[model samples]
Target: MTAGRPEPVDRQLPSDEARELLALTRDLVDREVRPRSAEDEAAARFPREVFRTLGRAGLLSLPYAGEYGGGDQPYEVYLQVLEELANGWLAVGLGVSVHTLSCHALAGFGSEEQKRRWLPGMLGGEQLGAYCLSEPQSGSDAASLRTRADLDGEQYVVSGTKAWITHGGRADFYSTMARTGDEGARGISCLLVPAGSEGLSAAPPERKMGMWSSPTAQMHFDGVRVDRERLVGGEGQGFRIALAALDSGRLGIAACAIGVAQAALDLAVEYAGTRQQFGRPIADFQGLSFLLADMATRIEAGRALYLAAARRRDAGRAFTKEAAMAKLFCTDTAMRVATDAVQVLGGYGYTRDYPAERFMREAKVLQIVEGTNQIQRLVIGRHLTGR
Candidate 1:
């Protein structure tokens, strides 16, 4: 910022103050993200510049080490930033979440050399990343994936298909989970697959009901070869890495859900206050007011749920159940709140003229991705029963 212009935002982390930083992040989102979202969604196009913009702003890799060109902010603050981003552009938020999932493999399990080689471009957002876990035959049961990466004389010759990949061929690299040993979960091994590797190609983007702006596609790995150095952890530890990523990935989706819901509620409240009904503004109606009230309540509850999970994680506590709870609660709340937001807008909500429709579309994918809300409940239920 120059004279007469607001100061450029400070996204750096200092352990002493979080509220102030989050407010700044919110202002940054209002200034940068909210203004361009409509066009981004309308085109169903990925903004390559947005990634570089976030990279320049130092806003993309919160919770990752600054040494790796990340902000190194705590999860609590990182998530609030994501909330504001999603509230502005769901595609951007989902991209960050998927990128984080890709980073999870390196951060949690990568060798020091691996971290050094890969973390810069990723944490800087100079390149996008995708996690290849789900296949056509397996979504929740990722271990049952048919993709195979067998060792050749000097490399692993990989072959199979992965489905519903967020970045797919568009990403610079894929964090792939493939069968490398015997059948079942124990057989899966995680590997790093570069995009455009020989024999690797992504199918046409999915014709989806929502998240149309976020590219989704099926990946084909036809004899793609990778060196042993590309293996993430060990021969049979793919399931562990996959589950570990999901544990944290669930929080990212929860944050995304809360943000979308918040955006929908805000739009609904504003529309209700200004739109005329009967002889006055529709906000005057008790029925509509109550709907707004419930919307606010649910948004607050969902925000609290995700933040609690974030805190528990930062504290080094066992937080699987909490993360799952946040995912389940926030995603469902998003669906309910988005539906209500549409109702508040009447026919306008059902059309592209307003964002409520898009919000609703984006909300559905949050529930389906990361883990289905049903799967989230099963995770929590299992923990509750001490299973």
Candidate 2:
């Protein structure tokens, strides 16, 4: 069955502006994103222009202050837009999320001069960004990262590798974390390193199971010197900044997960309603009907969970545990829903002539990125036990 654009989620936005923003997001997704997604994925082509288009349209800077060229929308509205984008293409949706995460430190903690100088270009459509946190040796255990940035007179000399960086080679800037002092989490600090720094370079992108249009690679900083002015927050503040960014970033991942699951479910439902089994549409049978029901229910539940977390964040509540819970539940739900969609399509899903297989592959990465679902569980458990 040919996959169609899934129906838009009936989002309960807070204002006319938010409603209009969602409408704009849908229009852009249909006109610019969906048509090129399958082709780009098949060719392993990165859609830099598509991101530039998003930037021009102001989708790039939602959920930040308007004074710094942000859209100034609430997280609830911003996340729904993310869900819609991911419904069109996971790479694009996740890319926006990562870009926003990369901007978090500078936008939230940078000096007024830094904001005045850099935020406009960063938040505007002129530049794309990457978050540099994970390393070859430190994946889930991020606090143990060995990448170092030593103060050398008027600048900091950065040297090390950051692994699994989205937009690694292509980003205009990198919000990098590096050790500046003692050998622990407290030693780490944040820096906004421009992409063309003398010693900064990237390895070839990873050959992944899906989302080939979104590049992931290792970035090398070979004594790359950044001006002292680029340091975000304070020395020894990177770990805290990273964790704060993650709480919101996890919600973005959760929204993207739901979008993928929703797409898979929509494709499955369409196929089931049309495909005949024993001279009758498969959707008429209780077995297939029940499966579709479960998929829809899971998508709805996941959407609600992520939105609840977003609302807490928007309201300035401590949402660390809630964000983790949403990330864990939503990603697990996406994997299940995508698998069920593939099963519903039988042989077609396996071949990827249909997107069910792609959905399944894409769903796997959501559980691992931002933070592993296992890591999410640990975070939730910590909140519960205060341990």
Per-residue lDDT tens digits for candidate 1, residues 33-114, read 7777788768787776876777677777778998888787778788877877888788888788888888898888988998
Across 1-387, the per-residue lDDT of candidate 2 in tens digits comes to: 445565667778899999999999999988899888888899999999999999999999998999999999999999999998998999999999999999999998999999999999999987999999999999999999999999999899999999999999999999999999999999999999999999999999999988899999999999999999999999999999999999999999999999899889989999998899899999999999999999999889999999999999999999999999999999999999999999999998899688898899999999999889999999999889999
Candidate 2, run of 10 with poorest lDDT: 1-10
Q: Candidate 2: misplaced stretches above 4 Å? A: none
**Backbone clashes counted, model 2:** 0
After superposition, candidate 1 runs with Cα above 4 Å error: 1-24
